[model samples]
Target chain A: MTTSREIRLRSRPQGLPAAANFELATVELAAPGPGEVQVRNTWMTVDPYMRGRMNDVKSYVPPFQLGRPLEGGAIGEVIASNDPSLKPGDLVQSNFGWREAFNAPASSVQKLNTHGLPTEAFLGVAGMPGLTAYAGLLRVAALKPGDVVFVSGAAGAVGSLVCQIAKLKGHKVIASAGGAEKARFLKDEIGVDAVIDYKATGDSAAALTAALAEAAPEGIDVYFDNVGGGHLEAALNAARPYARFAICGMISMYNAEAPVPGPANMALIIGKNLRLEGFIVSNHWDMMGDFLKELGAWHAKGQLKWRQTVREGIASAPDAFIGLFTGANMGKMLVKLA
Target chain B: MTTSREIRLRSRPQGLPAAANFELATVELAAPGPGEVQVRNTWMTVDPYMRGRMNDVKSYVPPFQLGRPLEGGAIGEVIASNDPSLKPGDLVQSNFGWREAFNAPASSVQKLNTHGLPTEAFLGVAGMPGLTAYAGLLRVAALKPGDVVFVSGAAGAVGSLVCQIAKLKGHKVIASAGGAEKARFLKDEIGVDAVIDYKATGDSAAALTAALAEAAPEGIDVYFDNVGGGHLEAALNAARPYARFAICGMISMYNAEAPVPGPANMALIIGKNLRLEGFIVSNHWDMMGDFLKELGAWHAKGQLKWRQTVREGIASAPDAFIGLFTGANMGKMLVKLA
Candidate 1:
């Protein structure tokens, strides 16, 4: 038997989760069972969607059970295997997060094709966040060439990839970031046509509208919404006829104590002939092969870029998740648990 | 030369439009020039969308210009024609509405194929509202057989057709209307599985949710939204995973003095993986032939039914339009001006 440390949900959060909401528990793991493999986790992802899972409400993904280990995207190495499919030393991915190690059926985890790239890339640009941006812009938003696209939370994981992908596809990209540093990263590094510093703006919606008017004078054809509320209203006001909005994460409202009121100008959806569709990355697994092919090619060609904000150790996972709502991370926020 | 009586928008309304905001004016009509025809109006249509035109803001349809005649679907007979395609006594459809008669280029008027049906049907069941329902369901919502559909404003022009069509497609239908009379029409005449009288419940959203729970115990797969605001909230709360929402209209918020807050629980879209798309019927004009063929067959077989509230004469057109906001009309509202 071996000892392993895991972060477990202690209680459901009211709004923003505190340290008291989670407990770092030590567990003893027995030898791998039939068709099972023992994994030593290297890296795990903490995302905005995980915030929703912390709540007890029913959602697309099931809520995190109290006193049980929190689950998310994790990349690990197979240390021992009772299954023929996964052997020792194989790098695999699974939804067994906030833990130092885990033992699961081999079928539940996937062997990663690192392809000479860093294994951590699978948790950032080449994983769920990357696929989300791909499927969202092309499939959901129906992005056409030359479409002027505005992406909210552009310095974040999915939003950053969306900006790069839109730019590479010959569309003019306008990106919004929470801070000046993040704004600089988008404009200077990501090569976005325009960058709006949302933190500096007194009225986010009004400022977003004014900035969008100058950046995309013809009006936005597609809006990739990662932040909802005022940003959604701004996009609605600035959308051209037949504009398409890929509704991804609404990180802005995830930690609100009270129910956040939606965009006041939602009637604009009818008048503007807009299509706003919400999607989950898990539902678009079929697009993974196509997404990987395109994204891999782009990465090889030096057309794609990514960054990571790491929170060391499993104990800090809760703080890392809570940090997401405050815009503390510049890119994909992850917890390294070796 | 001839004299015509017309209703012009005297001024833009602040909240709900009133009689004083319109002017009954007499205008001189010129005889048909080359390729022009003089039309004597017979029947005209008043619709909810016209309320948007009363505002000075830009929209899918152009705003009704102050001191100018309002335009909408009108059926008339050509009295004089300079075009070879149109002859005297031929019934045609034109957008020159709220008028007793008008002379326009023959190219601007479409000769209607009455096909032994009432000429007035061209303004209701065979026209824009019918097409709105057809394209909205099959194309926008992607209604699959056996899906449970909930339609708001169920006895109105677009909503009534939506309910009937969904039922014909082998889907269970839940319809909501303002009064018991309209609800009865939906249940008995329209063959909906359930009916919700919105007026009976003071809290529209709560009532709608409770009624939907009882009607569609499995939850709604498709929501055809003709009324937004609280109804939208109910649909959001009651929608199942991967539900599709075709946002055809938002009559509830059309005349709001201040911007109404959207559904507080719109975050449900993300959890349910919902697709809420707003579309205009004019954009899908290519589907007209298919629409007419299907709708005509249904009408011929007597599987489809429609009711019209006729406000006699062109002078009553303003009142007819105002009545739409109050849910006074059961189906398509029309104005008779023979």
Candidate 2:
């Protein structure tokens, strides 16, 4: 018998999630059934979109069930294998529940070899969020050379890659972060052309205008929308003709008890011929291999950099997860089990 | 010299345009300057988009310069021609301004020879607004067989054709109009599967839900947005996964001083994988001939239906234009200059 800890939703969180929303409990795991592999979870990824899953509303992804281990993208080592695809001690990634150990079928997990890359990167750089940023920027936004990319929520796991990928593709990358320090990391570390501390600006229109004029003197070609509302509106205004905006997340408008105000300048879209698309990462998994290969080379060359505000224990996962809206993390927010 | 009566924008209106903003100017025109043709304007289009032109703001097209003749799409008979491509008494379409007689270059006007089609059809179903609906529906929304389309301001110019075109493409069309008369026209003449009267319902969300249930029992595949606001929100709610929306116009928010309250449920976009696009007709002129051919065939076969609120005299152009937002037109609104 193996002892494993699991975090379950105590109650649905209203607005911003709190410590009261999550509760951890110990579980005893039984031996793996036929075609099942037991995973010893090592790393768990926290993302802004996961907050939406806490609500029991119909969305693209199903909502987290009450009293169930909160499920998300996780990385672990297969300690026991009943499936031939995996052997004991092989690392894997899956949409596994928030458990220290769990027996899942081979169908759920993707085996990870690392191939001289960081082990934790399977949940960050080459993970779902990473591929999301990659496919969205390349496929959805169709980022071209010399195109200007304005990424909202720039410090987060997805937006961070969006900015970096745009930069690597020869685009002038401009990003918005909630704090000055995070904005600094975006400009200094990631080589984003411009970073606006939206918190300091207090006005998205002004921030986007000033930042866009500096970053994209020619015009904005691609707007990778991670945060919606005012940022989306400002982008709409600054967008050149035939611009593409990939609506990845609306974290800005999420958790609002009332209707969020629409960006007043939406009328600009028709005249400007804007393409605004809203999509889910799960829909674009076919592009994953290409993304991993290219991103790995970039990582090995030090052309790509990743940041993590790691919560030391699974116990602190709730705070790190909730801190997303307030901009507590620099890059990807993750939890390490001790 | 041809004596021309013209409707000129004397001043920019503040909110709802009044008759006072326009002045009837009579200008004596000199003969065509070598390559020019003197056009006697017959039918002038009164469209909601003209409202945006009334404001001296940066729009898709330049604003109507104050004290200058307001220019728009019109089909006219060439009273006199000096160009090789055209002859006297030929029917042509051009942006010849809102004037009874104007001297325009031969390059500006395209001769429309009844070609077994009604001459007025050039100003309505086969012209800018009509081609706009076609391009936007097919090119942007990508409406396919069995797609469910919802058009707001459905009895109006662009929205009416959008509903018909979507239906012609084997789609279920749901329309929302301002009054009972417009609603009846949408169902009876427009052949939309369902109709919602905005005036009677008084609530966008409820009316849309009811109309959506009736017309799009399957789900909303495309949103033809002519009326923006809660209607956009309503369409967003009724959208299926990978649904497309063409933001052609936003009559609901045009006069709004502030941002319209949004669907607050926009986070649903991430879950649904929706595509909301904004387009212009000028960018899609290459498909004009094909559209005109198909629409003419549909008309000849009696499969296509149309109606127009012909406001007699050039002086009524401003009033007729403003009546668009008020749902004063049954189908296309054309200002007749006699």
Instruction: Give the number of the best model, judged by TM-score.
Output: 1
Pick by lDDT: which candidate is best? Answer: 1
Query: Compared with the true structure, what per-residue lDDT tens digits does model 2 show for residues A169-250?
Result: 7878889888888888998999898887888877566576776666667778898888888788778878999899988988
* DockQ list for all candidates: 0.77, 0.70
Question: Residue B250 CA error for candidate 2 (Å)?
Answer: 1.0
User: CAPRI verdict on model 1?
Assistant: medium
Residue B173 displacement in candidate 1 (angstroms): 0.6
Number of the predicted model whose DockQ against the real structure is largest = 1
Candidate 1 structure quality by residue, lDDT tens digits, A141-251: 999977899999899999999999998888899998888999899999999999988888743677878877878888999999998888888899999988999999888
In order, what lDDT does every prediction score? 0.90, 0.83
Q: Per-residue lDDT for A312 in model 1?
A: 96
| Model 2, span B1-338: residue lDDT tens | 88989988999987778889999999999989899998898888877788888887877688889899988888888888889888888988888758898887899888887777666667777677789889989888888777888888788777888888887777778888888888887888768788878787765665766666666777888898987777887888788999998988888767665556545556667778888888878899998888988887888788887777889988888788888877789888898875
